[model samples]
Target: MWNHNYEDELIKCHRFAVGLAKEIDYKNQRLLEMEHKYNETMATVCRLKEEVKSKDTRFLEMKQKYNESSATVKRLMNETDLLHSEMRKTQSINRKPDEALKCKKKELDQQAKELEESKAHNDLERRSFLNDIEKLKEELQAQEEKTDAIENLNSVLLVKEHMINQELQEARKESIESLQNMLTGRSKLGIKRMGEVDWKPFGDICSQKFPGEDWAKISAELCSEWQEKLKNPHWHPFKKVMENDEPQEQIDEGDEDLKELKTKWGEDVYEAVTKALLEMNEVNASGSYAVPEIWNLMEDRRASMKEIIQYIIKQLRAHMRKRKRC
Candidate 1:
């Protein structure tokens, strides 16, 4: 035997080197991803902090303005009290046989007019201050809400990091297991791969099954490079709603025949009607409404589908635009 143990050692070393390389690559990729996310999150946090700082500055300015307004109001009130006391003293003097009564009366009238103008100005300033305070309060509330949303985002990020760590651990465990299999005189190793699921085809399937289901709606919302957002595992619609989704199962005890009709057709009939109502030209729409196939579906349920069709038509040009870009 030409060093059989040495050959075995060499084989084991090769396998270890391969596994180590793979593990390193995996770790490096994950590190890059985590760094990217960290940078982005840090940027967001920085932006929010700047916003908060600005808001605080504005709030302080507002507080100063409010204080100034309060002081102004207090000064005006004190002036009013002094004016009333002076007017009383003038009245008493007038009652004691004044020489320049007309002159005194004219002076008193002028003073009263000035006082009225001052009061009006004071009232206007008070109203302005109150309005400013209200606006400030609204802004503060909005800022607080934004802060709350940011905190929630941070929490989500933390959860994502935790999940990623768990995934790395699992990958390591699996790698160890694979290595163990290779060493234990196992003849075969089977590998499983995850395939990608295309959403558009699935949406199309859903659309056809329920034609009135607004396939165009999804296409309408699609924009440039929007799919890049899907890279974030936490961003999926189902993942988002998974935590809080409480399905409310309710039984509809309406007309049995109508319910039966709905159950038989599912969403397709409604879609067909939607297509007829929405996509057709005016002449076609009017002509199709008269057809038994179009109206009978709704008529059986004792519902006026025509009204809703008319309403939508009046609201917007009701037509399903073909998906071109997405």
Candidate 2:
């Protein structure tokens, strides 16, 4: 019984050992396949690990670039803000000069308008001045013509006076001869003639008293003295007398020649000459009656009052004759 039990135990033990060996063989085979697969998986894992490592290096580079770009953008933004501030200041500074330029332009336009108006006024004044000059020229021409007419009238009168003087001288000589003949006949008949006196003896006595002086010589001296007196500024022959009244005294009352003529030539001759002088002064006092200036062609000096009166009378007669003929 003991042996049988021992055999059974040994058989069981052998079976158990065999089963355990087979199981161990299967496990070993499976373990070899796993090991092959593991070897392939390990190669794949190494390749994947290498790719992950490259990706990590690229990400780090991108992060560094992003930081640098952010810094640059901040700097650019600050420069833009400064530029805007300077532009605003420039616009504020330019405002006043632009307004002043506009005001200066307005003033220049006003000055130009005033200059145009002044030019127009000057043109009008020039035309007016030209018209006045034309009128003055016409007046001067008329005055010249009147002066020429007056000169022509004076020349015609001079010739007629000379002829009349010669005829009067001839008539006076004939009358003086007739009176002397009658006086001689009365004295021969021994008849007393009223107011008859011998003038020849009286003339001889007067000549002897004067001693070498004659009437002609004394008359020339008196004329020269009178001419010098006329040159005085205060010497005026015509007195301002009332109408229809004679002057109280002659202007030449103090003249020595006049006193001598009165004493030598007697009162009648002095009175005749004085009356002629007074008439000439009255007629030639003023206005148209005043004598025109006449030059004596024969004597080469100023014309006497006697010559001027004769010239005026002849001019009047010639004008009257011309009117009658017309």
Candidate 3:
């Protein structure tokens, strides 16, 4: 009976393993599908961008053609006017009345034919231009619609990606907790992430502060104001290292000047700096600010204090992006 019970337990564990394997396979399949969809969307966006460029080029070319056609029409109309002037001058003359009248009438008829031909050609060209313009407008409208669709798709994908990521994390956490529970023979395994950041100050600033101005400049100005308020603050980072009597270990991260300020003030000063950057970044309106790109703008050894601020802001931005992604 004990052996039979052991066998029954083994069968149950095998079934559990199989179910887990099947679930993992399903998750993997879903991940692949999401990645495939993402790639396809990016390709479509690139294609649309190229199409927009081509459309702009075509529009410019059409505009040039239309301008040339207009010039030609103007010249032809002027010629027709000149012929009318000549006819008026002939009518005013008294010499060789019948002969001159007959000659003038023949010339006028020939000129009229040329004028009619020119007018017909101009009308045809105008119609062609209008048709092409209408076609171009249609293309632009279609492009706009596609852009809206892409934006909507991106929004949906972002949300779905978030949900999937959360599900994946929860699944992994549950799996780990299950193994631990089995080993320890406990019903509960306590695990939790960091507490939420207080966004009330940030929200208040967004609501009350400079509405239309460039927030970066405002932040820069605020930074300057803070420096003015601090009677004796290290402007240069290297100065802080030099001020110390004892040689310090190499900093793993952070600018020396900012680090010194942190030593002088509090570590939580970052919250203030971060708040300013967040306001300046306008990330909700735009998207994630690329930190690697910003870092590249400065050569590591030669960057200034101002650049250091930018680097710090970017670091904060990178952190924000990671937090938001998670």
Q: Relative to the true structure, how large is the alpha-carbon lDDT of every model?
A: 0.51, 0.54, 0.54
For each candidate in turn, the TM-score is 0.27, 0.25, 0.29
Which 10 consecutive residues of model 3 have the lowest summed lDDT?
287-296
Say which candidate scores most in TM-score: 3
List clashing residue pairs in candidate 2. Answer: none
Sequence-dependent TM-score of model 2: 0.25
Candidate 2 residue-wise lDDT, 26-143, digit = tens = 9999999999999999999999998888764654444454455455445544554554455456558864445544464455445545544554554555456558778999999899
- Once superposed on the true structure, which residue ranges of model 1 sit more than 4 Å away at CA? 1-99, 183-326
Q: Of models 1 and 3, which has the larger lDDT?
A: 3
TM-score, candidate 1, is 0.27
Candidates 1 and 3, the one with greater TM-score: 3
- After superposition, the stretches of candidate 2 with alpha carbons farther than 4 Å from their true spots are 1-109, 166-326
Higher TM-score: candidate 2 or 3? 3
> What does the lDDT read for residue 265 in candidate 1?
41
Residues 1-326, model 3: lDDT tens digits: 99999999999999999999999999999999999999999999999999888875765565566566566657656765775676668667844456665676576567656656765665676678679889999999999999999999999999999998897656554544443323221212222211112234333453345577665565455455443332222221221244358853333236655555456444454455433333323312121221111112223222233443454466579889999999
